[model samples]
Target chain A: MQLSAGARREGSPWTGVWAVFLKEVADHLSSTRMRILEVLILLSAVGAVYAGARTLQQTVSEDPFLLLQVFTAAQDPLPSFVAFLSFFLPLAAIALGFDAINSEYNRNTLSRVLAQPIYRDALLWGKFLAGLATLALILLALFLLVVGLSLIFLGVPPNTEEVARALLFLLATLAYAGVWLGIALLFSVLFRSAATSALAAIAVWLFFALFWGIIAQLLAQAVSPYDPFRPESELRQAEALVAFSRVSPNTLYAEAIQVLLNPAVRSLGPVLITQLQGALLGSPLPLGQSLLLAWPQLTGLIALTLLLFALTYVLFQRREVRA
Target chain B: MVIETQGLSKRYGKVVAVEDLNLRIEAGEVYGLLGPNGSGKTTTILMMLGLTEPSGGTVRVLGLDPVREPLSLKKQVGYLPDSVGFYSEMTAWENLAYIARLNGLPRAEAEARIARVLERMGLAEVAHRPVSAFSRGMRQRLGLAEVLLKEPKVVILDEPTLGLDPEAAQAFLQMIQGLKAEGITVLLSSHLLHQVQAICDRVGLFHKGRLVLEGRVEELAQRVLGGAYRIRLGASPLEGLQARLQALPEVSRVSLEDGEVRLEATQDVRPLVARTVLEAGAALHSLALEKPSLDEVYARYFQEVRHAA
Candidate 1:
């Protein structure tokens, strides 16, 4: 019931979380980095969508609704949107996160800020939240532009199913960003230099996005001596390789988004083999089923990011502020 | 005492940066930690600030455990590290406001406090300018301004004047005295002995992580200089003066260093010598007194470290 005057000064009920959050945001937001990121993402999203609209205008009709009708008539709009966004959103997410944590530590400013009466968890959480918030803000602006322009030109409110599909796409995109942000933060924590951190993060991103699929295919082909083109056998072999390829976050997100956005898809095909024709044999899986199948892979990617971040926190705490 | 330590030592693997040291600093006292490079003065200060851990000692600041209670302890204490730099891209105002907010000053209060400190420290002219443009001295001033914005109970500076111009250093010393007027406990470390001599109420000379000597600067000097006294007798026969001084039994040895009588007095023979000089009819052109300077006292200790090495 009694406290000394001295003890009163030792612990503030404020964990100093918000202060660190605002400061971390301020560190990047004030500089040209934030502006550069915003400009690059907005321009690319707007430009790509505008380019798609232009291409549709030339091929189908000048009327945007006519273009939408043609796309929906050919195949479900969900799959088409999924195909379009899978490539764009990952780029945006990677751009937003790639250096969030590493740059601060590289600049020798992290320790100075942490030395203030803030918990390490707050600092880590604050940085993560700030990066996520910035990404969300950028995404929101892009969403408004894309949806707004589409609505104005098409002159039709998106149907319930289409809206639901769009929402799923949004969720998957955000999750994909989470995966990148985690890896970036992890790399940031693991590496000492901003450039090195960026290089390592980009290398991991590229490996997952482009190279892993090819590597898994080659590995699958080398292991399968039978005519991998035989329908059922080819299907089994393709699924095994697909499972292996899904281990990389990029491939999993890309494929999952494709499935979620394409309402028409029944399956991803009988796992492709040898000639790559067998890969297209299986019917495309439905959006829901694809997501269910990819849940473990998605979670594993996110967990890996968190694990890297936790390791970084430990290392950061162990570091001596010699400078 | 505002700050006290008991045998504080810090080891970085094989390197003993600081070793068994005892220090006491009182409130409103300008305590100077004097040492050359790598003498562990900075290491000691960092330990006191709870920034570094002592390998085998305890440090208490403002009656709080610095290590276990750093946040609470730091809130009441301000530290200006040697070569402390701010966010170069931020204006001085922004940098100060950032640190103030970190210290839990609300936005409005932080702005007001930052403005007042900047004005008081004469940093207002360039307050809005990015810190990257600030000169070394201006940056130092801004650093101190940031600390003062918190209104800390104790201020600890490491080499605060090391990179300042002579004029700036003079002004800075005056500023420190003003801090004393406000009852702020100031602990500053310096390699320059004269700087400590001018501003410090008490000085501690550290070498190899240990405090070799500490006292009110004048007292330490007096203790060393008290061993010898000069007796000057002008016209009269030296026999009476010499016999009287020697027979009094306080003088241990009498010799002339440079044609001036030097007495190795067993005790302070000031009164006896004064009376002897007057009665002996010696014209006291000047009873020139000599005392060991803080530098001289430190030199002897430094020699010990050298010899031991």
Candidate 2:
């Protein structure tokens, strides 16, 4: 019944959410934490792109999509631009949002803020939109910078399809960052201390980024045992392992980017030799097919973000706001 | 009524913060809620603001149910919490501007109102200074400025003078009177009886989550103590003056200590007592009618209720 009231009222017009959104955006932009994270991300991105551009030069004469390799190619001691993004985007998002709600509570300004004529829906939505906007802006800038640097280094402009695919990859990366931001926001709502929320968010990121692949491997070994006795069982075990790992947003991001950036990769799982008999060995798939391949991963990231956001909205609305 | 509550109650699981409370405040009246700690003053204020849903009953402000029309109601009602906290990193003007935007004021109008309120609260010089550098009194004044930003019809303040020095408290009380003169309904809550007694037109004494006594300060004191008069004699050792005062039929009871005589009388017996003191060879320095103080009234009323229960 409360949810229905909330839902019905959700349609009612609110003018103040935008004010909160603008203020929050300004606050996030001016924060020292965001500044530090921005600097760190820029340094890593520039390093990774420079490293990848140098490696792409060797294959520039034959490869028509040489610039696309700036996002995927990696040499020793440095990963690609996309790789650095996959590693640092979540950190930036969590840094931006880990104290989004709790900081207001701790500062004793939340109750006063809510006491204004605005509804709680506006407050939560505004903060979320501001954070997402900040993340999107930063991601867009970094993607353009990488593209520009690659354009100069590789001396080959990307074709329409390649540009489209890179843009899609950037969009996917934003969604992945959104998922982590939502997780961090959920922690912010659940904990009163900013330090606690920050620690919880990092703990979750560490689990997914560092330990999840190993855990999924161990889980597959335990559940779908490797019976070397049966050759088919090996494929099933590997499939089980990938399936388990897909639950982590990191895995989804990596898989989605691989599909978008590498058009030669047609499937996320193993394919039979007979199934690929007529397929061109190294020809890149069309952009539409790649998007179709990455659609499920993109949907997974979006759903996770939505689920976290919904939880935050409901909890924040029902809370007393006494602090 | 500017504000009305019908059988309002809030139960936090097993603990009832406020219960079966009914209050009616007319327009332009300064109503003070007087109670000790844990007496449900804050709970009542929260319920009235529609911040916390009541377990039973309803609250109406400006003829609109706060729960049903909280935004509309809040637009007309300004509230100052016991301890006001602003965004420390922001300047006072910036903080007020943020609240103004949230309240749906136009940018130009908000700027004008922010400047006006800052000047009125004597913070115009420091309007651009960060709130973190403000003292407690300055913060309290800034809080008042924030409350007045919207030109609200009703203002609810919870212990607006909680941490102020004596001089600052006096200034804050004077500003509250200014609010009253502007025809705004103010519902203030505080445990400082004397301060409330000074500015409040009518007072409600809350005990154990219930409104035990509600009336004007002087009327409540008279109602509780029955017109008892305290007379302070000029010199000590008024040994026979006490007996003579007790013998007068108008005086119902008499007690003497430290050159002061406290007498309970059903009517004004000051003239009769003065005559008796003079005839008894005792100098009558001062004789005045003494109604019970608001502090005594609160204490005695709470004690009687405790004893009865």
Candidate 3:
């Protein structure tokens, strides 16, 4: 500052945000629990790839479901290994993210971090970005490992089109995890305890991934049992159930990936009887075309995740850091 | 205002953490905010740092409104909480380097400054050790090292001597006196009277969330404590010496004992005292003037310490 009157003082940037971000990343990576969680997630991803490979072999021998496809890659389940991953990958993603924000608050570090030159938005976004980075690295490693295994077992590497489709699947699943990460952080900021946040997030996951479908099925049956087996009512009941399933992000991701992989799955309705149903009625688009058709579902999932993340930012800004 | 507060209050639901506090601490002076447990010392610090909003009036620090300019104000300040914690898994060098990075210290300078501060705080021996293994005193030193790494314009520390042994605490005070020599303002907060009394240029007394008293240590003592002088007589085998001393106007009270006299004077009358004892044919053995006890003055404000007993 100049000594004379009316002289202007120099300004400073908010380096506090960067400081807090580095501190948080350090804290998370420094813990043994982080390593344990990392190993657990990768082990599950590897386990899924193994299971998917086994399933692909059995299906190929018996022509299970008599599924057929136009492209050679689509002749069997696409992503040959990702089919296994989709089953348990959310657990890995959830474990990494469920308590990211809440646990910091629980440990009383959030207040200390923000007491620096940092703003609330930076703290929330920094943690999200760091966590998402960690999650992505794990997922990418598993993706590469799955591809290696598929090449080893099937004796053929994926073609360009197959590779593009597989990358899209991976991206879609990441977006799915991003949405849940945002949701988890929101809950974390809302709750003061890591245990509470983890429990609440896992409970929500159970509801969407498994229990929600069962409850919806029971509700749909009680509401209108219009016997979709009858050709007259087949379209309406199938449409109702499929629309209901799409309400779940898990359902959307699963259906989008399944349709992308299997050309014979014309509709993800009451059952996987559609490939065989070609002998009886009809089929929809080929696998690639079906993937393109499911683009909106993928977009919706990504949009929802981004929206949840934005809400978390707003709530974090409103919170007072007194710790 | 370098720092100002008017009727600022804070409450945690049913508990009023701080209520109706009004204080003004000016620039270029070491201000001590002294209070006991739950007296709202930390609450006031949090508000001043913009970590928590005040429930009542306004507060301004460094000529920027704390709430309105938190981002700017924080950049100009360094704070050390009572329970100082750091990235425990990182080495001291790594910890200080990371904080310096966050503060946008230029690369070469940040490393150099970290080294300087680590050496200054006497942490050079264990600079490479992870803070997880740091002793309590070592951790406190590391915390001070982090704040000093940036050379902030205003350094705020709460109970800085809490975990330090006498040698370390004395060294800490000397370091703060060095900051004062640089003309940087500091807020040295502690509940202990002697801690603040030792180094602070001025002290603010906090009781029940309000700043009940504030001034320079000597000035407040004189105003609140009045003046006192202790006079002890020796070799007083001379006859009628106690009665002769009590006969003086300056003496408010007098006590007599074996070969000595204790006088609590209402005014400075050392000359009269010496003359009276000598004229009475007794030697004046010892006389010591004392500063007013902050402990006594502070207890009067709390009114809970039995009114100075």
Candidate 4:
């Protein structure tokens, strides 16, 4: 049973990638950290949905898109499900990926795994894809739970257009999560200590999610300050702020989700009365128009994700596995 | 040749890790790459595996260029890196199964191979246990199991017994012998002279990024130190016997240490030495030919290289 011919299987070059993907999937699913993160996110999602449901009961009759409101509804005491996800999904992505590369290096398994009949591209790709797959699964489950809870509360099925918009929003969220996962993987490849990579990933997330908006606003202010006497300066100031905010993946994701989930939102930027002169006053945009509005933001998020992965792949390939 | 390298070199900036290495290993032969730490043994192995690209020259494993088609060569070759690591969270069976699946083995064949490899490595009983609980020896054994599971045509082991105890090291050497018996060409690198001497059919003594000496063990000894003999005497004073043996035309040099006279000779002079010793009334307890141990040859070779440099 020599392996000379058994190994040169020409058909499936991705066997190693698939094998690594399955192994990583199992590791992530069975890990205590994953379980804890899952519980944390699940509890937070349920808490937010319950609060949203309580607040939606009073306005269910007035709101035609009651099901869509379940995602964005927030009472004085609780945040919305989308808000919770925007804050917590990054944690899940980072948690799943912070040690993806460094742990293998620390354990001395990277060399052995590379010694097998697999390319480095496959190994790294498998790990990244597996992390994304896990993120997808968790997001899918949370979305289903949110929908299930919202259905019981509203007692009304969502329209086909609403469902399509929500599904697009879900996909946008996955792309958002993928961006963070790629960043975490890049840090993992950069740092030798898993703790360092984890901390770095969390720090980046905190900066983008919490501090980046304020910093971007300040920088925009410095770049284009408002002169109250000159009303045109206000437009320039707002444009500067919007341009700076787009640098953060958080802003891009939030804007895309807002457009997808709320068809009433026509533009992410400030709009003038002249632009809305011929439009219906209170009608929502069609699903296609909503997607078109969010396309740029979605493309930005996807490009960020790919850029991170490309950097990681280059670093991993150039690195000496044993030194 | 199962393995070949032509003027292979690796340089990191200005520092040369391996320089102009020309090596060849025949099929079914056990070749040892012996060197001290930082002597380029690991670098050479990495170059051969195409894990590290050479700055210049070429390498072929099993008639395939490793750099052009590393995956192809890797398919027919197995490597056990120094301090071989597996996923600690997974069981031994799980780790091996993962590797099997990576090699494109079907599920049933993978399971069967895993069982056979684990049984052969004496880890079948603990196959279900997590690898974190395994001892150093057990991990080394597991590393061997990984390398052999595929039955590769060529096996490369980098410091296979670095941390093993005496018994484990012996067991590892025996397993390397077993690989040769199975018609597997093995290229193992080690800094330990005795370990390489015991298992290697031919050895290349690497020094300062260059192979300074290479040949069979006895042939290397003869080339470096010449034909020699050691005769132990029981007499209180061996002055007369030493004089008589040194006076013989066949003897070139003589030295005494711990009541034993070491003789450097151009021919078989044991019989002449024994006759002289008996004639001079010196008690002759044992007579044996002396071959320079691999360490002595290595030291001498390196010293010569240093002086030349």
DockQ each:
0.33, 0.58, 0.35, 0.52
| Real contacts retained, model 2 | 0.65
lDDT (0-100) at residue A123 of candidate 4? 86
lDDT per model vs. reference = 0.70, 0.86, 0.71, 0.87
Sliding window of 10 residues with minimal summed lDDT for model 2 chain B: B228-237
Clashes of each: 13, 0, 0, 0
- Model 1 over residues A111-159: C-alpha lDDT tens digits? 4555465555666777777777776776667666767775665555766
List the candidate 4 regions with Cα displacement exceeding 4 Å: A1-15, B228-235, B238-245, B256-261, B266-271, B274-291, B306-309
lDDT by residue (A183-225, candidate 2, tens digit) is: 8888999998999999999999999989998999999999889
Candidate 4 chain B: worst-modelled 10 consecutive residues by lDDT: B228-237
Using TM-score as the measure, name the better of candidate 1 and candidate 4.
Answer: 4
Clashing pairs in 2: none
lDDT of 3 by residue, A1-323 (tens): 12454433224333355665566666666667568766855665455455555555655453322211111222233343444455556665566567776665554445555656656666677777776776677678777766776567655556655666667777777877787777788788777777787888888888887788887766666655777467646555566666777788888787777666554566556654545654534444544677776788789888888888888877776676654
> Against the true structure, what is each candidate's TM-score?
0.77, 0.94, 0.80, 0.94
Predicted candidate 2, C-alpha RMSD? 2.4
Pairs with backbone N, CA or C atoms under 3 Å apart (clashes), candidate 4: none
Model 1 lDDT tens row, B1-309 = 899999888888999888888888988999999988899988888787666667887899999887678887878888887766777888999888778777888888888898899998999899999889989889888878977988998998888888888898988888888899999999999998876578899898877777778888767755654443434333244556666666667776565454456565646666777787778786444344454467766775556568989
Q: A202 in model 1: Cα distance from truth in Å?
A: 3.4
| RMSD in Å for all candidates | 6.9, 2.4, 6.4, 3.8
Model 4 chain A: weakest 10-residue lDDT segment is A6-15
List residue ranges in candidate 3 displaced over 4 A. A1-84, A102-112, A221-247, A268-292, B11-16, B228-289, B304-309
